[model samples]
Target: MLSKAFPRRMTVFVLVMLLVEFLDEFTFGVTETAWPFIRNELDLNYAQIGLLIGIPLFLANFIEPIFGLLADTPRRRLVMVGGGIMYGVALLWVASSQSYAMMMLALILLMPASGAFIGTAQASLMDHEPDRHDQNMARWTFAGSVGMVIGPLALGAFLLIGSGWRPLLVLIGGLMMLAAFIVWRLPANAALRSHASDADDAGEPEYGLMDNARLALGALKRPAIWRWLILLQFSDLMLDVLFSYLALYFVDVVGVGEAQAGLAVAVWSSVGLLGDFLLIPLLERIQGLAYLRISVVAELILYPAFLLVDDITLKLVILGIIGLFNAGWYAILSGKLYSALPGQSGIALTLGNVGGLFGSLIPALVGIVASHYGLQAAMWVMLAGPVVLFIGLPWRTDKPIKLEESAAK
Candidate 1:
């Protein structure tokens, strides 16, 4: 039986993870917030801008599997510490970058650094209490939401006050370095470690690169897994990539000032944060798949309204409600995927990375379309995202093996 102390320890771990995520996201948020300014300063074309965002994310997909593999080991916590440091350093590098090539190099470094912490962190959370995976993931998303809320607002404030964007990078880098220190000092929770030891004792074959590769290849044979990947990639188009462009969209298309656009992003995140908080309790009442289906349907309706509606305040309100509905899709999706794969956290996370890689292309694709057809027309492409989700992902999933228990078999 798990000790009562495990929950307390897990709580501490989650809090520390929250701080780390805040710092990580603040750095990324700075980049996103500064992007419009960066585009203007660099005089970059849409395709060039797309490459800037897409290439680093694409490279990160390759790194995620390796990090996922590492997450399954005893050194998972230590890996997060290293990742935090790398993330900070990369942000500093981005701060000093004078050319597109230099910025590109710095972003490339950021991707692997991110992979180091993210999958490991998720594995840690789920391993702490498999039964509470959904709740725990809600908290995980909540933490990220907090960071997302703070990041753009901070950058926006700086921009509003005439401090410019580069200083925000330096500030974020310093905070990231602090986050690394905090993670390094984090107490090791015995429950997750014990689970690791139990799996080792159960004579699970040590998975090497080749073994993991074989598993990944074998996973492709399952329609459910790849189907989930496709759905997720499209969902990201609306959820992730769409937000990435939100500030710029408001500025360029909606005829808003940069600061207001920043606020729009902040509104989106703030509501999402509250929604994540609510989602914890809501999960008790609503089934995960059903909730996801409902949320997607809501988005299917809300997104078009957001585009067609002229009032910025109304648009903000719509985005907040959309945030509320979309809150738990990732948590549910990740929990289900992890449940399906059992011990293969690395492969499961790698699948997300693969989806993210394709999803990264959406920004570039939108940029290309926007260049020819205009920004408003480009956004119409996003409608395909929810439509795909509704079509591809079903409301029911096959029973998934609990990886921790299966390890003992």
Candidate 2:
């Protein structure tokens, strides 16, 4: 579709970047949805589930900056393809794992692998079309949402075929490899598409790694950088972290069975896909910050309602609405972050990874709170996602962003 709309150079770049994000999230949807079965089989408790999710996030975030840095270099194809290969192998390892230790090893490998491939791919997109950050991120998010929607549905189909999560994941692993092959084969452009960074990011290719590290670190001095990065992690509470726990909440808190639980998750992802698809045009019609401000306020009302509701059907309905309202949070926030650090898409990834260091522990913390106080009690922690977003976004939403100017305020 994009190839028809764009020139030859932009066509291949958009397809590859979108494909990478799509498959990356498709696997996440599968892993998260498969949690109940995995928990039952492994006899794991809530905290352990949290540990499994959290520990990998924690470790991966610290390591991901290196990949982000590498992505801004002349050898980006090597970095991107290498990450894709490792990501696929890690998925296969996860499929073959029968024990907690084995799963942990695979997940630890999986997280950094995603940073290398998915995060780097996103960085590539951010580097192109310096003015279209919001519009491009919206397309990127939409692609990911399509993958996310398909993931659980794929799991459901496999379940109907009398196969377990393991087999489904194995197939997804193979699909991931195919995605990597596409990326590897995509034609490179002379316009710094994916193989190299823009001039602002690559001061001198021959400069040592330490020099690049220092330059990325310089992004920290801008207050605008921290604002968006912090909001990104906080936003995940209502976003990915919620997705991580959604299946468990349905099964444990709502008392729905496995099939119903899968349907509930699918409903959330499907509506989210709708929202992301709509956001691309919305970005063109309105300023990104204005849309974010509206979304954040709506999240405050819906998130609490989502927690307090008891009926499974009503909850699913509200869940879809929640997904709808929060749809553009990532696309807009990240777009603004990229806007703030124009031409340094890799630096955006590096800063985002670092900011998420502590936030990665949130899932585990939620699990612990659930274990001690029950899932309902622990669920309140998610409200912080909206609460913080409401406060974190700048008060003045009417104007276009001058992030460098605002960062100092």
Candidate 3:
């Protein structure tokens, strides 16, 4: 029987993980908020700034599978701590950067470290309590929601106190260090260690680079996984594109100041947290594919509303609703993806991250479109992505499968 304390400890671990995510996400938000300042200081153009922002995500996504493969090894905790240290150093480098090229190099190097830590942390949590997978995962998702809320707000508040970006970067670096310490302190499980040793004793074939590639390709070839991946990619694009530029859009296009824009973004993230909270219970009632279909339909309405409305207040309302709906989709889809590939959670998550990387490109592309064409044009282009998601709903083969049944199989 599971101890009552187990849930509490899991919650604490998840919160600690969220703190790490907050720091990681804060770097992006801080950079977004500080970009105008950095641009003026560095004499950078829009294209250069865009590259700086997009490159880290591109690198992180590309390297995630490699990290994922390493995560399946027995030394996950060590990898996580080392990755955290590297990420912290990278952030400090960014804080000290004096040139565009230097900043780019810092971000590219830091991203893989960050990606590794994220994969390790997630794998650790899932492996910690495999029996309580859904509940634990919900807790993890909740923590991420909290982090998303805090990251932008903290950046905005810190910027208000000091104009220079150094203070903000240093603050984030400190948080990352703290996260690394917590990760280091996580108790080792004898059962997990024994399981790994037993598996090794059995002389199971070691998975190499080719094996990893084949597993990823095998995952992609599944029609069910493919459908979910498509939906995930489209939805992620819509969300990432918004986050990457929402602050800028409000500040530059909507004539709002940095503080107000940051607040709006914070509200956007907060509402997403609320959405995830609501989703916890809702998930009990609906299948993963059902949630995906509903979310897609809701987004179709919300996406157009987001673009069509110009009122600042109305825009915030629309963004809040969108955030709430968006929260449910990822968790639910993640559950589905895990179901699609039983007994391979680590690789499944890595493949999902890869899908997310492809999804992230859509927003970067939107940024370029906005730069060349118009902001509204970029927004209009994104509408089609979600619409296509809805169109593909009929093709998905996902249905509710009881956890016990999945485990038995």
Give the root-mean-square deviation of each candidate in angstroms.
3.3, 3.4, 4.2
Task: Report, for every candidate in turn, its global Cα lDDT versus the true structure.
Answer: 0.75, 0.83, 0.68
lDDT tens readout by residue for model 1, 205-302: 44665566666667656667777777767777777777777887899999999778888888888888898888887887878888888888899999
Model 2 sits at a Cα RMSD from the real structure of: 3.4
For model 3, what is the alpha-carbon lDDT of residue 47? 57
RMSD of 1: 3.3
**Which is the leading candidate under lDDT?**
2
Instruction: List the candidate numbers ranked by lDDT, top first.
Output: 2, 1, 3
Error of 2 at 52 (Å): 0.5
TM-score, per-candidate, Cα-based: 0.89, 0.92, 0.85
lDDT of 3 by residue, 251-363 (tens): 77778887788777888878888977777767667655677677778888997898778898998889888887777655655556666655455667678777767665665
Q: Which stretches of candidate 2 lie over 4 Å from their true place?
A: 1-5, 8-10, 190-208, 396-409
Candidate 2's residue-wise lDDT over 199-246, tens digit each? 434443333345557767666876667788889999999999999999
Candidate 1 global TM-score? 0.89
Give the poorly placed runs of model 1, Cα more than 4 Å off. 1-10, 189-206, 401-409
